[model samples]
Target: MVLANIQQGEKESLRSYTNRFFAAAAEMEDVNPTVAIPNYRRGLISGDLSKSLQLVKPKSFPELMARASQFMLLEDTGNGAPDV
Candidate 1:
C-alpha cells in the first residue's frame, strides 16, 4: 500500500508530509484506522511528534491528526522564535 509505505522525507516539513499523506489517502477506496494509524505514526520522523505519538498512541485517525496538527503548530512557532 502506497499510504502504508509513505515516509517523511529527511527535509520535509510536517505540513508538507501531512499534505502528501492525505493526497495518497484520498486515492484509496477506504482507509482503515488500524492501517492508517500505525502507518501515519511510523511515517513520522523521529522528533517531537514521533516521540509524542509513541508515548501516547492515538486511538483514531482524527485523534492522530489532531496531535500532529498541534506538533506542527509548535514546530512552526519554534522555528520563528529568536534564539537567545
Candidate 2:
C-alpha cells in the first residue's frame, strides 16, 4: 500500500499509511525475543523509531544488551574490522 501510494504520487496518503503501520506495530502485546528485536530494528530503519524503542524497552535489559552485542558482530570476519 505504501509503494502503491508512492507510485500514485499520494505523498500524504503514504505518510498516513506509514504512520498507521507504526501505530499497529506499537499495539503488539507480545512478541518473540529474537523476532521482536529484529522487527524493532527494521522499524527503526524504516522511520518507526519510537515503535522500535517501545519493543526494546519491555524486554529484559540483558536481552537487549545481548542483541546489541550481536548487532556489533553481524558481519564479523577474522580481519577484526568494522563491517560498515
Candidate 3:
C-alpha cells in the first residue's frame, strides 16, 4: 500500500499531528513499529514530550503512545485548556 508522507504543520498541535500520523500509518498494510516509531518521532516538532520519549526509549508502539498520552494530559492540565 502507498502511504502518504506524514508531516507536522507549524501551527498544528501534538494531538492533531499524532492523529494524522496514525491515519497515514493505518493505510500501510504492514506497519512496522520499529520503523513507525522513529518516523513518528522524526515528524514531531522538538518539544518536551519528544525529548522525554527519546530519553525513556519506549520498547513498543503502545509504550510510546502511553508516554505521549501522559504528556498530552500534563500539557493540557498545565495550560488549563481542554484538549482539542
Candidate 4:
C-alpha cells in the first residue's frame, strides 16, 4: 500500500518507487508479487488490459505485452477468436 501510494502519487519517480516497492512488498495488505500477478492474469482474461499492464511494468513494453498475451486468446491470422 505504501509503495502503491508512492507510485500513484509520484508518477515521475521511478527510483523512489523501486525502493519503496521492495520496502513495502512484505508489509502490503495484499500487494505481494504473488497476489498482484494473479490479479494481472485475471485482468487479461477479463479484457481489462490497462489494469493488467499496470500490475507488472516489465523492463520493456514488448516483454510486458507478451506476458499479457499468455492469457489472451490466440487470435487466428484472420483476426478471429475461435469459440471458447
User: Who is ahead in TM-score, 1 or 3?
Assistant: 1
> Model 1 segments beyond 4 Å from truth?
79-84
On residues 4-73, what C-alpha lDDT tens digit does candidate 4 reach at each position? 3433222322234333444555566655564453333332323334454565555543464465454343
Q: What are the clashing pairs of model 2?
A: none
lDDT of model 4 at residue 83?
A: 31
Higher-ranked by TM-score: 1 or 2: 1
Q: Write the per-residue lDDT of candidate 1 for residues 36-79, one digit (tens) a residue.
A: 87888789888777777777888887887888788778778875
What would the TM-scores of all predictions be? Answer: 0.84, 0.24, 0.79, 0.29
**For this target, which candidate reaches the highest TM-score against the unseen true structure?**
1
Q: Is candidate 1 or candidate 2 better by lDDT?
A: 1
Candidate ranking (lDDT, best to worst): 1, 3, 4, 2
For residues 1-84, what per-residue lDDT tens digits would candidate 2 score against the true structure? Answer: 221122212332323433454455456656345554444344333322334345455365355544444433432332332222
Instruction: Estimate the Cα RMSD of every predicted model relative to the unseen true structure.
Output: 4.4, 12.0, 4.5, 10.8
lDDT per model, in order? 0.80, 0.39, 0.73, 0.41
Query: Which residue pairs show backbone clashes in model 1?
Result: none
Candidate rank order under TM-score? 1, 3, 4, 2
Residue by residue across 1-84, what tens digits does model 3's lDDT show? Answer: 223357678888778887788888877787888888888887888878767767767778788778778767776577632322
